[model samples]
Target: MTPTRARYDAVADFYASGWPDAIDDPASLRLLTLLEPIAGRRILDLACGHGRITRELARRGAAQVVGVDLSAALLERARAAERDNPLGIHYIHADVTTWSTPDQYDAVTCNFGLSDIDDLDAALATAARALRPGGLFVCSLLHPCFPGGPNVSGSWPSGGRYHDEGWWQATGELSSLRRQVGANHRTLATYLNAIRRQGLWLDELSEPEPSRDWASGRPDAARFPVFLVMRWVKATAQP
Candidate 1:
């Protein structure tokens, strides 16, 4: 596992404990909604941490569902969950940056995992390669702007240097914000451009609504979008 994913594996237990905001997380929900899988279509859940949506896809009647992650710790938990249902989900522990899949899936999804990936281009390329022509590539990531301010570094009035807001960054414990924890950060433009480079045509862009609970308790949560959802189709070089 890569250093970033490994870090998440070590902390996988925290998420399973019912990440307080799990139900309110719009990123994963948006991706799942866009997938719209048929009962027998093959689906790939790239970087499926703890198999949350992975299980959902299988339950929704996908013919084959595969969840790949770089962290063994999280994969272990995913495996445990699969054991209960035994729907035959293939769990792979590998880095998406280098993994490859032939034209094997009707759809590929990356829910809240793109921004954390180091090689965004390679990852998108892999997703594109894995899909048959005209197949869909659905993914969600941190909004390039808003919510977290400018992801810049500067000195605050408190007289200490600190890293400011950034894409795909979350603050955890000790008033410290961790950037690029399980994945790296990328701008919205960068994402679109990368998908194009991977022979995928942008189809739609969506921003999911934060759950009612989150909006009520965290006023600023909706003010700044915390997630972005995108749908793309494989390009066919035809007139």
Candidate 2:
């Protein structure tokens, strides 16, 4: 694994144990709904953290679900979760940017994982390559316009400004997390660009607001973008 991947592997245990919210995020359910994987279809959960959606897909009766991530630590948690449910999922430790498979999948998913990847474009291309013709790729990211945007200038609910210092960027467009990590910003445009570059067609885009509690804190967030869900389909050969 690359150094980046190694970082996650080393911290996987802590992430899984300490970040329960990360593993049990509602975003997984939301993204899974967009995917709508049929029974007996193969699906790939790119950057499947702690088997959140991977195990969910198995429970929903997918024939085969493969969850791949660069972090062995995260994969270890995923494997442990599978052991409990005994789902027939295959967890592979891999860097999503370069991992390749001879087989194709009916659907590919990456929930809230794209923004954290370093080579966003290369990762998207890898996803495109793994899809069968007409296969769908569904993923979610932090909303690009408000908190997720380059300019984190927004009105706080408490009568102050909540600002994040950095330039807004899209996936593969060069961005950093907390202004240090190599994570990329996954703006809507950036995502679309990557999809087109990979020869896939955009199918849908959605902005999901936070739940009641979160909304209650920053009511204005309802009017702004907080999270984005995107779906793309591979184009088929034409005569």
- Per-residue lDDT, model 1, residue 80, is 89
Off by over 4 Å in 1: 1-5, 19-24, 149-169, 172-183
Q: Residue 62: error of model 2 in Å? A: 0.5
Candidate 2 lDDT, tens digit per residue, 1-239?
45354545555655566545343444555777788745788999998878877877887899999998877778878888778778999998888888889989999999878766778888988898899999999988766555422233221212222333223322322222223323344445666787788878889877766677756655654557677788888988632
Please report the TM-score between candidate 1 and the true structure: 0.82
RMSD of each: 4.7, 6.0
Residue 18, candidate 1: Cα error in Å is 3.2
Query: In each prediction, how many residue pairs overlap at the backbone (N, C-alpha, C within less than 3 A)?
Result: 4, 1
Q: Give per-residue lDDT, candidate 2, residue 66.
A: 95
TM-score of candidate 2 to 2 decimals: 0.79
Error of 1 at 237 (Å): 3.3
Candidate 2: the clashing residue pairs are: 150-168
